[model samples]
Target: MPKVSRRAVLALSAAAPLTLPAIARAAGPADAKFEALAKGWVDANLRLNPVGATQVGDHRFDDQIDDMGPTGRAAIIKLATETLAALQATPRAELSRANQVDAAILENQVRSDLWTLQALQPYAWDPLTWNAVAGGALYNLTAREFAPLDVRLRSATARMQKLPALLAQARQELVPARVPKIHADTVVGQNKGLHSLVDGIVADGAKLAPADRARLEAAAKTCKAAIDEHQTWLETVLVPGAKGEFRLGAALYDAKLAFALNSPLSRAEIKARALAEMTSLRATMYDISARFLAGKPGAPPTPARPTDAQRQAAIEAALEYAYAQKPARDKLVEAAEATLVEATAFVRARNIVTVPKDPVKIGLVPEFQRGVAVAYCDAPGPLDKGQQTYYKISPIPDDWTAAQADSFLREYNSLGIQEVTVHEAMPGHYLQLAHANAYPSVLRAVLSSGPFVEGWACYAQDVMADEGYLDRDPLYLLVHLKLQLRVCANALLDQAVHVDNISRDEAMKLMTVQAFQQEREAAGKWVRAQLSQAQLPTYFVGWEEHKALRKQAEAKWSKSFTLKRYHDGILSFGSPPARFAGQLLFDLPIA
Candidate 1:
C-alpha cells in the first residue's frame, strides 16, 4: 500500500465533500463519521509504516524505519481493532450504495490486518518480513527521482544510521526455534545483496557536497559492516536451529484464504471450481495439440479422442516448436522490449481498451528484490499517478549451472515472453492501474484489492488470444493455453502444499506432468509456495470472477455490449473487489 500526499487528500476532501447521496442524506452523521475513521486509519498506517509511506511517494517519513518489536506490533493491533469497531458501529443500510461498499471494503481490510498481526504472526518466524523492511527503506529512497539528490541522500543517511537498531530489534524479536529453514536460507541470500544499496547506488550515484558526501560515505560503511555481521549471525546462529513448520494447515489456510480472496466463496468451493476448470482447460489444450500434430507420423486424427499418452506427446511436440524460438540468454531483455512495442500496436489497432499516455520502462530486477517471481508490474504508487511504471524482469543468475539456465530459458521462450509482456504491460497491469489511479476515490485507490489487480492481468491474456493477437498464430495460442494451465495449477498447488501437506515429489509431478512446467520453474514455485500462502491462488480466483462478471454484463447489455466499453467500465471504479465493480456496473444492490 502507498501513502497519499496531504495536498491530494485535502483536494479530494474539498471537492467531494464525503457525505451520503441525495437519497440517504438523512444518514449524513453516520456517513461522515465513517469517512473520518477511514481517513484516520490511512494516516495512522503511514505514520507507523514509514517505509510503506516512502514507497508511495510520501517523503515525510523517508528518514525513518518502522519499529517491528513487540511494542510496535501492539500499536498496530490496537489501531486495527479500534478502527474495525468504529466502522461496525455505522449502520450499513443507511449509507448510499457507494459508501456502503466503501464501508465493507474498509471493514475487511481492518480485519485482515488484525488477522495478520494476531493469528499469522509472521514477525516471530518469517525473516523476509524484516529483510524487506530494511531493503525497501533504502530502495524506495534511491530508486525514484521524486526529490533532489542531496535531500534524498540525507534521508538515506538517516535511515542508514538506524540500521543497527532495526537489525538489533530483529535479533530480539525472531524466535530461533520457530524459523523455517527455507526462509532462513532466503534471508541469508538476500542479506548479501543489501550492500548494493551503498556500493552500487549511494556510492556511485549520489552526487553530494564534500562534507555531506563524507558523512554519507561513513554511514554507508557502517551500514555495510552491520549487514555483513547480520548475515554471518543468520548463517551460523539462526540456520542451524531453524525448525518451523511452513504449512498453515486447514484452519489457518481457510482464514487466510477468505481474507485474501475477499470473495463470498468457501475454500471447498474454490477447490471444486479450480479442479473442474483444470480438466476443461486440459481438454482444450488437447484439441489444439491434435490440430498441431495432424501432419506428423503416427499422429491421431483431429476428431479422435486421443489417449492420455498421445495427448501428452502432441503437447510436448508443440512446446518444442515454441521453445525453439527462444531468445538467447543474453538477449532476453531486448526480446521483451521489442515485444512490448508489437503488443502496444496490436492493442491500439484492435481498438482494445484505451491506453493511457503514462510511460512504462523495462528494466532488470534490482538485486535486492530478486529471488521471488521472474517478472512484476511495478506501477507508481496510486498517490503519484504520473511517475514511471517499471516492468522488472529477472535475468538468470550468473552462478547457475548451464543446465539450470537452459531449463529457465525454455520456460520463458519467445512465445512465453510475449504472453508475459501482454500481462505486465500493453492491455494488462500497466493500463488498468493507470485508470485506477485516475479514479476519483483516494480511499479506494489506496486500499486496492489484490484479486482485482491480478485478475485483470489474467483476463487480459484471454482477451488478447480471443481477439486474434499475433495474427492468431497457433503457436502463440498454444502458449496462451499453457499459461492458463499454469494458472489453474497454481490454485491447486497453493492449497495442496499448505493444507494437504503435499510433498515435493507430488508437487513436481503435478507441475511437470499436469501443467507441463519446466523443472527450474517448478523448483522456484515450490520455494515460493513455502515462503507465502494464499497469494498464488489470486490469479486463478480473480480470473474466474472477471470472467463471470464479463458474462453477466454481456447478458445484461445484450445487443449494446462492446468489449472496449465493458473493459473501460469495469476499470472506471477504482480497483475494488470484482463484486463491488459488478454492483456499480450493472446497478445491482451492493452487498
Candidate 2:
C-alpha cells in the first residue's frame, strides 16, 4: 500500500502529452495558443519528473530521478499555479472542441497537483512516497526494452548513484509526528524488498562491459546499504513517535474525491448510488446463485430480501464450484498466460470489440511493485505504442505460510484468473489502450481519465458474460457477479475508510463477509484502501458511466447502434471522462 505519487499515478494512466500533428488548414489564434501551452506543459512536467518521462517512453530524461526536497516541490507548485492562471485566461469559446476539452483536463490536473502539494502534503508525511520514487526510477529502466541493454544499464547506474542523496533528503524532510502508522509500517516492509530490484532484475537483465558492470554492481551495493540505513531510521526513530491521523476528514476527502472522480456527481450522490447498486447487485447474484446451485440438496431457496446469513450462504455455495477449479500456487502466471489466449480468441469469434494486434506478455510482478493490487495492466506508453504490454501478476510471496498461500489461491481461483485476464488483457485494458494510443490527439491520450479506462474494463467483463463467453456457463456468470459485487463494495469501502473513520475490523467485515473476498484478499485491500483515496471507487463509478453512455447511444441511434460500433466510436476519442465522451460522441457542445 505504498502512496501512489503524482508521478507514479501519471505513469500508471496518462503518460507524457506529445503534440498533435498539424493539418494544412489555417488555425484560430486561441487554438494556436492552446497547442503551444500543451507542449510547454508536457516538457516542463517531464523535466520535473524524469522517472515519469521514462515510463512514458521518453528517453530524454532517462538518467535522472525527481528532486523531492522543499525547493523542488515549491518550484512545481509555483509552475502549477501560474499555469492554472494562464489556462483560465484563455477564452474557452475561441478554441476548437478538442482543444477545449484538453484545456479543461489541464486545468484540473494543475489544480489537483497544487492541492496535493499545498493541502494534502503527502511528501512530508507519507514514507511510501520516497519508496515508490526509488522503486519506479529503477523499474522504468529495467522493466522495458525501450533502449539498448548497455544504454539502459548506464542510466540505471546513474540513478543508483543518486539514491543516497534522495534517501538523505527523505530523512531530512519527513516529520515523525505526521507519519501515519500504517504508511510507516507498509514502507518498512517495502524497503526490505527494494534491493531485490537492483540485485535480481537489473543486474541479471543488463549485459554490460566488465567495467560498466562493475560500476553498476558497486553503485547498487551502495544504494542497498543506504536503503537499509533508511529502514533502520524509519523503524527506530519514526515509527515509535508516528501518530498522524489517516482520515482525510470530510472536507479534505470531499475535495480530493472531486479531483479523483472527475465527474459531476457529488460525494453524497456517489455514496447513495453505490449503496443502491450494492443491494441491486446482490439480488442479481442471488438469482445467479439459485441457478448455479439448482439441484444441490443443501442449497437454500433464494429469498426476495435475504438476510445477511442467507445471502452469504448462497453466494459461498455458488463460489464453491469456482473455488474447486483454483490454480496451483506455482502456476498462477502460467494460467494467466493461457487465459489470455482464450480471452482473445473469444473476443475475436464474438466480434465483441476490435481486438488490438499489439503484443502482450505476462510476467511476474517485480518486488517493488507488490503490496498493492495483485495484478495490473501495464500498457505501453502512448509514445511507445509499438512496444509490448505487460499483464503483471504477483505470485504468493515465498515468506507466506501454507495457509496464507492457499487462501490467496482460492480467492484468485481458475475462474478468478480468467476474469482478471479478460479485464487486464484482451478486450479490456490491452485492447482499449491500444486504441487509445492510436487516437489522433496526443493531448487527449496524455490526460486519460481513470474512470473511462477502468470503466471500459469493467464494462468489457459484463459484455463478455453477456456474449456467452465460456458458453454462458453458470459458474463463469456467477464469478462475474461476484466480481461485480467486489466493484460495488470498493466504492463503499473507499469512502467509508477515508471519511467515516472505519476501523480494520469494520473494513474486513465489509470486504470478506459482505463482498465474499478471501481473508488474505480482504486484508490486502484494507492496506490498499489506507494507501489510496478515491481510487477504489473508480471501477464502479466508471462502469456506471459506461453503462449510461451505452444506453444513450442505443436510444439515439435506434436500430443503428451495435456494441462493436459504439465501442469503437467511444474509444476513438482516447480516454476522456465519460461525460466528455458522451458530449463528443453525440456532438453535444463542450461545457
Candidate 3:
C-alpha cells in the first residue's frame, strides 16, 4: 500500500474520503486492518473539520471550511458508524500491544463523536460549540507558522470567504430556547473577538503575494460582516431566549464523563475520591502550615492534633505569606518565564525525567480564547516541523477593576504561579508533550487522552514539590497544597453543578472556603463549571491515576525504579489514558 499524502486526500473528493474501504470491512492482518480504518477515520475527520485539520498540521484541508449543515453532519454520522462497526469486528486479540491501545483510542473517539452528534447534540444548545469553531477556524490558521505566509494567507482568505455560511448554519441549527444563557452570553464576547482575528489576518496579508493579498483583503470584509451579523444574533436573539439547563443531570453527565476521561471511574466514584482528597490535602496543608504559622502572631494553635478551626485558621495564615509575594499586575508573564527557567533547572538538577529540549515560549492567551481558563500549553501539530509550544497565560483585561485584579493575583500568588508554571511549562505540559509528539504513533498523538496529558502535568507539579524544587520552601509547599485542593474541588464542583444542582452560593463557598480559593478565582470558576462539563475532573482523576501508577511501578520495579526511568517509560507510550499507559509500561495485558 502506498502512503497517501494529506493534499491527495483532500484533492480526491471531499465527501468520499470518509467511506470505509473494502479492506477495513474485510480484515486480513488485524493490525493492518485497524490501520486502514484509522487512516480512513483520520482522513474523513480532517475533511469534516478542515479548520481542525490545520491545527493538527494537515494543511491540505486549510482551504475548506467544515460543512456542519444537515447533510454534512449526516455524512459524519455515517463515517463514525461505519468506522466503529469495522473497529468492533476487528480481532483485538490478534493485534500487537501498541495496536491494541490505538484500537481502543479509536473506538472511544468514534463513540464519543457518535454520542456528541447523536445524543448530546451541543450544536442545538451550546452556542460555544459554534463559537469555538468560528473562533478557532482563523486563529489556528494564523497563529502557527506551519507554512509560508503567502500560502497560509491564501487559505485564510478561502476560510474567511466561507464564514457567512458557517454562521448561517450556526443560527439555523441553534434552537434559541435550548441554548444556555451563560453559553450564549459568553459567545457574544467571543464572537466580538472574531473581528480582531480578521483584522490580524488582513494586517498580515499586507506581506502576502499581490493576488493573495487582494483575496484576503476582500475576504476580510466578508468575514467581518458575518461576525457582526452573528454578534447581533447572539446578543439580541439567542441570549434573551436561552432558557436551557446548563446541568447535564446524572445520565448525560455520566456518558460525557466516560468519554471525556476514558477512565473507569464513575461520577459517584470521582466525587467521593475528590471530596476525600480535599480533606486529605487540607490536612496536609495544615501540617505544612503548622511549620510556618506555629507561634506566629494571631495564628491559631497548631497542636499535634488540631481542631478544624485551628487547622483552617493556621492554613489561612500561612497562605498570606504566599499571597504577599504576588507579582505586579503587569508582570505575570515575566514572573512565569523566570519560574519556567528555575523549574527547568530544578528538573535537570534532580534528574527527574529525560527533559526534552523543545522550545517552550510563553505568551498571552488570545482574546477569543479567554474566559475559559487562565493558561494552556498549545503545542504544534505532530506533523508540523516546528517544536515551539506556547505556554499562554491570559492577561488581565484593562476593564477589570483593581479589586478584581487584586483577588486574582492573590489566588495566583507567586508560589501558586510557580506551581502553575510547573504544570503548564517546564517539566509539565510542555516537557511531557514534547516527548509525546516525538513518539512514533501518529494515531495516538492525534487522539491523545486529556487525562494523560493533564495527569502528567499535575503529577509533574507533585514531583517538583517532592523534589524540593524551590528548596523546601514551606510557603511554596503550602501554596502547592492549596492549589491541589482546587484541583480536587474542581472535580467536586463539576459534579456538584451538573449533577447535584448546587447553587451559586454553595459553589462559591466550596471554592473560596473549602478549597481556599480567592473570590475572583471562585467566581471565574463558577462560570467555567457551567460552560464546561465533565472536563474539570480530568485534573484530579488523572492526578490520582498517575500517582497510583507510579506507586505500582515503584513496588514492581523495586531497585530498578527511578524517577527519570519511570517518567520516561510512561511518557514513551504517548498520551494514552493512564491505565493503558500503565499496562504498556508494566508489560501487562492491554485490556
Candidate 4:
C-alpha cells in the first residue's frame, strides 16, 4: 500500500515509522535546521521501530519486533514530543515553500500519533490495534523480498520468537469491558491469520541453512502456540466482555478528522458539501436513467416536472440494467484481470494521465485483510526493490449463501468492476503513487497524506467518466454516478455514525434508499464506518478538493492546460495533503 490503511496506522501496527520530512533545494537556515532534525528523527525512529523500517525497505533492524509496553510507548513519546516542540518553535515562514509543506505534514502526522497513543489510548480498548501489529509485523517480513529468503526468514523468525511476549503485553494492557464488541469480534476472526503467516514462513524453512532452519521451525512452534492462546483470549475474554461504545462521539471524531484530512474544510463544512453533492448527483443519475429507459416497455415516467418519487423510481429501474450484468461467481478474478487490460488501453488511448509502466497484477486479497475492505491497491513501498503492485479483491467466503453472494455480485457488477479498476489501477493509485515515489524527496513519501492518495484515485474515476470511458455508455456513466453518490454518502456517514448518534437503521436508509447502494454494500460499509474513523470521508472530500483544484488549474494554465500536464504537475510533489499539492503546483504560499 502507498500509505498503510488508516485503520492500521497505530504505533505498533504494520505502519510506516513516524519518520522525519525531506529537504528542498536552495534551503535557508531554517530549512537546514529542519533537515538536520528530520534526518536525526528518521534514523532514530527506524532504529526504534524495526517492522516499519523493514516495510519501508530499510534492512537494518529486520530482526526486531516493536516493544509493545509502556517502555516502548515512552521512547516514541519522547522522540515525538521533543521533535514536535522543536518543529513548533521553528516559524513556518522560515522554511522554503516546499519545506513548509513537508513541515506541515510532519506536524500533523506527529500530533495524530500523540493523540492516538496519549489520549485515545486505543491500545487499551481496541483489539484490532493488537491484531494489526501482531499480524502486520510478520506479514511485512514475508510479503516482499526486500532481502534474500534466508535473510527475510531469519527476520521473520526473530519476530515470531517475540509473539508470546507481545500477546502477553496485550493481555496486560487491554481492558476487556472497554474493548468495543465489533473490534473484539473482528480480532477473533483475524487471529488465525497470525498462525497462517507464521506457518507460511516456517514452511519455507527447508530452503534455509541447517541452523537457520532449525531456529525458524522452533520459532514457528512457539508462535503457533501463542497465536492459539491469543485466539482463545479473543473468543473467551475479549468478545464476551467487550462492551465499549463503537462511536468516537463528537469531540474525538472532530479532532481525528482534522488530523486525518488536514484540509481547510471542517466537519460541518464536509457534511453540508456532502448533502449538496448527494442532491446534485441524484439529479444527474436520474437524467441518465431517464435516457437509458426512455424507450423501455414499462419504465417509470420520468416527467420533466417529476416528483422526488418519480426520480427515485426512474433511477432504480435504470440500475437494474447494470445489476443484471454479472460476472460468474467463480470468475471474479479472471474478469477483473480482463477489465484491467481494457482500462489500461482506454487510459493510454485517451491520454487520461501518464500511465505508469510499473508492474501490477490481480490477486486475491489475503484472508486476514478481507473483512475491512473489498479491494486495495497494494503498491510497493517507496523503498522496496520489488516494483509489483497487487490490486487485491476479496473472494466470497465459502460459508455465504447464494443470496449473500448475489447481493455482493450485483453491487460489484461487470461495469462496476471496470470503474473500480479505473480507481485502483491504470491512472489511479498505481500510476499516481509511482509518480509520488519518484519525487526526489522521500519526506512526504514516508508518511503520505491519506486524502492525497485516496483523493487522486477518486479523481481518476471522475476523469474516466468525463472522458467518455467505455464508449460513453450512459449505463456506465450511470454506474459511475451511482458510485459517486456513495462517495458523498461516505462523507455524511462518517460524521453521522460517529458524531450524531445516527442509528444503524438511519445509516442503512441513507445508503440504500438515498445513495442507492446494494444491501450487501451498505451492510459492509456500516461495519467499515464503525471500524474506521475519519477515513470514510476521504473519498468524497478528496474528490471535491481534486475537482476544485482542477478548475483552478484550468483557469490559471488556460490554453496550456491538458489532463496529462495537470496530472503530472500536481503529482510531481510527493503525496502531501491535496491542498498542499495545489499550493506547490501554483507556487502559492504554503499557508
Candidate 5:
C-alpha cells in the first residue's frame, strides 16, 4: 500500500493526518486495502469528536462539534469497535515492520477509548472534566496564540454557534441513574471554570462581525443555561447522592490498564514497580535532606511532623517564592523566553541537535482556562506550519488569600520552578512538541502517543540535570527528587482512588507521609486524580522508558556517539511510541 500523505488526511479531517494505513505500510501491505482501511479509520475518529479538529487548529468542521449525547456516544463506540475488528483482521505478514508497530499503536488507541467508555462507565455526571476539556478547546480556538486572529475568530464563531446544542447533548447523554458521587463534586468544581469561559466570550464579542456576534451571543446564552441546569442537577441529584469515592474498583481498573497502557504490563506490575521506585526515591530524599541540613540546622531535621494545616501553609509559601521573583507575570514570561533561548543555545553549544527556527513564544494562561494546570506548552497542530508555540503560565488567582497564595508558592520553590521551566519551556514539552508538530506524517501527530509526549518532558528534566544544570546544586537536585516523588505519588493515587477502595484520608496520608506533599497540594492532587484517567502515570513511566532507551542507544553507538548526535537522533524519529524509538534506533523489529 502507498503511504498516506499528510496533506490528504488533513483534507479529510482538517486535523493532521492520522491514518493508520500510512503508519501500517511500514509493516508491509502492498495493496489498496491499507489505504481504504486508513481513510476509514481517520473518518470515524474525526466524526466521533469534532472538537479534536479545533484543538489541532483545523476549522473546517469547527461548526460541527460533538453533542456528547447518546447519538455521539453510540457513534464513537461503534467506530472504535469496528476499527478494532478491522485492524485485528489484517494479515500480520502484510505489515512492514514499522507499519506493524503503527497498527498495534492504532489498535491500542481504539481499544483504550472503548475500554474507558464501557468499563469505566464514567459517562454519567463528571461534568467537571467535560467542562475543563471544552474550555481548553474553546480557548485554543479563540486565543489566536497558535493561528492568526481572524482565522481563529471565524472558527470560534462557528463553534459558538453550536454551543447550546452541545451542552444540551451533554445533559441528555449523562446517565442520571448512574451518576457517580465523585463525578458530581468534580462537575461542581469544573463549572467554576466553565462559567469563566462564558464571560471571556461575551467580553470579546466585539471581535466578531455583527452576524457572528449574534451567533456567539445565542451560543453563550445557551451555554449559560446548560451550565446552570447542570449545576442544578449536581446540587439536587448528584451531590445528594455523592459517595465521594474516586476509583471505579479493581476489575474496571484492570480493564482500563490493559486498554490505556497498550503495554503488556498489568496494573499490579505497575504498582509493584511504582512501590519499588517510591522506596528508592524516599531514601534519596532522606539522603539529600541529611546533606542539606547537615551542620547548619539547629535541630537535625527529624521529619518536621507538621500538622496538615501547617504543611499546607509551608507548601503555599514555597509556591509563592517560586513565582514571586523580580518580574511580575509579564516579566515571568520574558524569563521563559530567555529560558528557551538559553535552552537552544545550551544544546547548540554542545553541538547536540538541530533546533528549528520556527518561532516559539511565551504567554500567560488565558483567564477562562487558568485553573486546570499551572503551565502548558501549546504547539500548533501538524497542519499549522510556521506558527508560534506558546508556553502559557497560569497566574495565581487574585481572590486567593495571602496564606493560601503563600502555600501555593512554596510548593513551587526555586528548584521546583526551574524543573517546571524545563518541562514547559526549555528542552521539554515545548521543544519536543515543536518537532512533533513538524513530523512528516500528520497521522502520528494527531494520534500522538501520550507516553511519548509526557515521557519526553519528564525525561528532559533528568537530561538537563545530567548535563550539569544548576551546577548539580544538591538543592535543585533535591527539588527534582521531590518532583519525581510527586509523579510517583500521582501514579499511585490514580490507582488507589479508582480501584483499591482508597479513602480520601488514605490518599492524603500517602501523599503527605510517603510523598511529603503538603495537605493543600495533596487535596489538589486528589481532585486531579479523580478528574483525569490513565494520564498521571505517564510522567514516570515515560521517563523510565526514555532513560532505558537512551542508555541502550549510548551503548550501541559507543565511541561514535556525540551527545548532540544522540539527542538529535532520539528526537528525529518524531515522537513515535518510545518502544518504537528503541526499535528504529537499534534496527530491531517494531514489536
Candidate 6:
C-alpha cells in the first residue's frame, strides 16, 4: 500500500478548538465573510477538481486543468489549511447551531481531504481515478445537454488543456511497482475508451465557436500529447508493476478507514458486523420468500450456492425474461412517471413528511456519460436557486442480446422499478437533495458526505416497503434485499480484497455463491470494488445510521413526533453525515 504523507496525517490528527474568536462575531460589512470564503473555497476546490465541478453544475472551470503535481498538491493543502483557519476564526456562538455543525463538518472534511491527498497519494497511480476520468468524460456528454453548446465547449476545452499535464503527472506518480493486475486489466479496457473520448470529443475543436476554436485547438494538441504519454506509461510502467493484491498496506488502510467512516470500527469489526447482518438478512430472505412465494407450499427458500456456471446460466435466463417483459422506451418513461405519482400519493396520504415542490424528470443517459454508475440522480446543487431534478437512466446497449436484455429488465421489474422511483425520483434522491439544497449554509452542501447521500437512498427502500408498494411481492422483496446485500458485500469486498488477501475467485464466490448474483453482475462488482473506496459501504451504513437516528428521535419526541415535524427537523439540520445528525438532534456535544 502507498504511504500517506506526514503532512496529511498531522492536519487530520490535530484536535480542533471548540469556539471561534470574538472578531468573528462582529456583524459589520464583513458579516458575509464566511459566505465569501465559502464561495472561494468552492471555486478553488472545484478548479483543482474540474470533474467534480462539472458534476456540481459549475461550468466556469469546465475546461480548466488542475496540475495535481507536487505544486498542485501543495495548493490543495494550503486551501484546506486556510479554510480551516477561517472556520476556526469564526465565532461559533454567533452562527446558528446548524451553521456551527456545518463549519465543524467542513473543517473535518478539509482536514480529511488533506490527509488523503498527501498521505495515501491516491492520484499518483490510483486506477480508480484514472478509469473514472476515462469513463466520467463519456458520462458528462449526456449531462451537457442542459448547458449551451458554447458552455460545453469551454468546459471540454479546459479539461483538454489539463489532460496532457495531468496524464504526465499520473505517469510519474503511479508506482508501477505496486499496480494490481485486475486494476491494470480494467484500465486496459478504460484506455480504449479514453482514446475514443480524445479522438471523438476532445480532438473535435472545430465544433467550438470561432472565438473558442483556437484555444480548443491548442488544448487538443496538449491533450493528444498527454493521452499518448499516459498510454505509453501504462503499457511500459504500470502494467508491468500490476501485482494482484488490492490492499493499500495496513497503516494507510487503517487511517483511510477511520477518516472515511468517521468511526473507530476496524476493518475486522466492520467485516464481523456485515457478516452478522448478512446471516440475519439471509434468514429473513428465507422467511419472506417462503411466506410470499409459497406456490409449492413448503418449497425451500431460494438457494445462494449456485455454482459459477449455474449462476451465469440462471442470470442469463433472468435477463432474458426481463427484456421480454420490458416496455418500449417511451412506455418505460411513462411507467416511471406513474410510479412517481403512486409514491407521492402514498407518502402524502400517510402524511409522513414534506415533499419537495421541485419538478422531477426521467431521462436516458446521454452518449458522453455512458459508464458512470448504472443510474444516478442529478439533483441541483444545494446552493443553486432552482428546483430541477433529473433522474438519469442508462439505456440498454443497442446490440444487447435478447436474453441479456431480459435479465436486465427482470432485475428492474415493476416492483423493483417502483423501489428505485421512490428512492431516486419523487422522494429519494430528488427529495433529500431538494431539502438539502435549501440548507442555509453553503459549506455543508459543498462538503456533503457520501455515507449520508447513499444511506438516505437505501433507507428509502424500506421506508417505501413499510408504506406499502406492490405489497408483499416476493420479487419486490428480493430486489430490495439484493440492493441491501450489495451494500453489505461492498464492505466485505473492501476489507477482504484490500485488508485481507481475498482473490478474484473468492470475490466471485462471495457475490455469486454467498449473495446470489449472476456472473455479469459479479464481474461488474469486482470492477467497482477495485475502482472506488469507502463508498459501497455507505448504503448499508447510512441506512443503519438513519434508522437509529429516527428511532432515537421517535422515542425522544414520543407523542410529539409528527411525521412532518420529525422529517422537517431531521432535514433542517442539513446534509452532514447521519452520525453528526445524531449528535445535533439529541443536543449532544460533538464527539
Best by the TM-score measure: 4
Q: Provide the TM-score for each candidate, comma-separated.
A: 0.94, 0.95, 0.94, 0.96, 0.85, 0.79
Query: Roughly what TM-score does model 1 have, to 2 decimal places?
Result: 0.94
For model 4, what is the error of residue 352's alpha carbon versus the real structure, in angstroms, after optimal superposition?
2.2
What does candidate 3's lDDT look like per residue over 1-591, in tens digits? Answer: 000111111100011011111112323477777887888888888878886677777888888888777887798899989998998898898887878888999899889888888898888898877777777778878877777788888888888989889999999999989988899888888888888899999899889878888878988998898889988988889988999999999999999999989899988888888888988899888888888886788877889898888888888988998999999999999999999889988899989987765667788888887888888777777667653578889898899999999999999888888988899877888777767766666677778777788878888888998988788899998888888888899999999999999999999999988999999889989999999888788889899999999999999999989998898888777678999989988889988
lDDT string for model 2 (1-591, tens) is: 111335434333222232222322216988888888888887788788887777766789888989999888988898898899899899998888778778888888898989999898888898888888888888778777777788888898899999889989988989989988988888888877788877854546356778888888888889889989988998898899789887778888888878877898787888899888878877777788877787888887667777877887898898887888988889999999999999999998887777666668898777766787898887656666467778889889899999999889888999999899988877888777777776665656666788888888899899999898999888888888778888988888888988888999999988887788899999998888888778888888899999999999999999998988888888777778888888888889987
Best of the two (2, 5) by TM-score? 2
Steric clash pairs (candidate 1): none
Please state the error at residue 84 of candidate 6 in Å.
Answer: 4.7
Q: Which is superior by lDDT, 1 or 6?
A: 1
Ranking by lDDT: 3, 4, 2, 1, 5, 6
Clash list (residue pairs), candidate 2: none
Comparison by TM-score, 3 against 5, better one: 3
lDDT for each residue of candidate 5 in 206-302, tens digit (9 for 90 to 100): 7767887787777778777766776786678667766544556677767765554555556777778888888787666555555555465353333
User: Which residue runs does candidate 4 get wrong by more than 4 Å?
Assistant: 1-23
All candidates' lDDT scores?
0.80, 0.81, 0.82, 0.81, 0.63, 0.63
Of candidates 4 and 3, the better by TM-score: 4
What lDDT score goes with residue 488 in model 5?
78
In model 5, which regions exceed 4 Å deviation? Answer: 1-32, 145-151, 202-204, 241-245, 297-344, 364-372
Which numbered prediction scores highest in lDDT against the true structure?
3
Q: Tens-digit lDDT track for model 4 on 140-237? A: 77776667799889888898898799998999999999888888878887887776778788788999999999999998999899988988888888
lDDT by residue (1-591, candidate 6, tens digit) is: 000111111000001121211212325433466657666887788777655555555656555555567887888899999998888898766664455566666677787878888787776556646556544543454343547666676777767766666666667767765666666665654565565665555445567777798887776667767667766777776788876456676677777766666654567777888888877666665555544433554333345564445443443333333224455533556767778888888877777667766567777654434443556676644433553557767677677777666555655566556777877765566666666655545556666656666677777777777666666555566666766676688788876766676888999988866676656567667776776566567666777777788899889989988766766666655567787777776777755
Clash totals for all models, in order? Answer: 0, 0, 0, 0, 33, 26
Let me know the TM-score candidate 3 reaches against the reference structure. 0.94
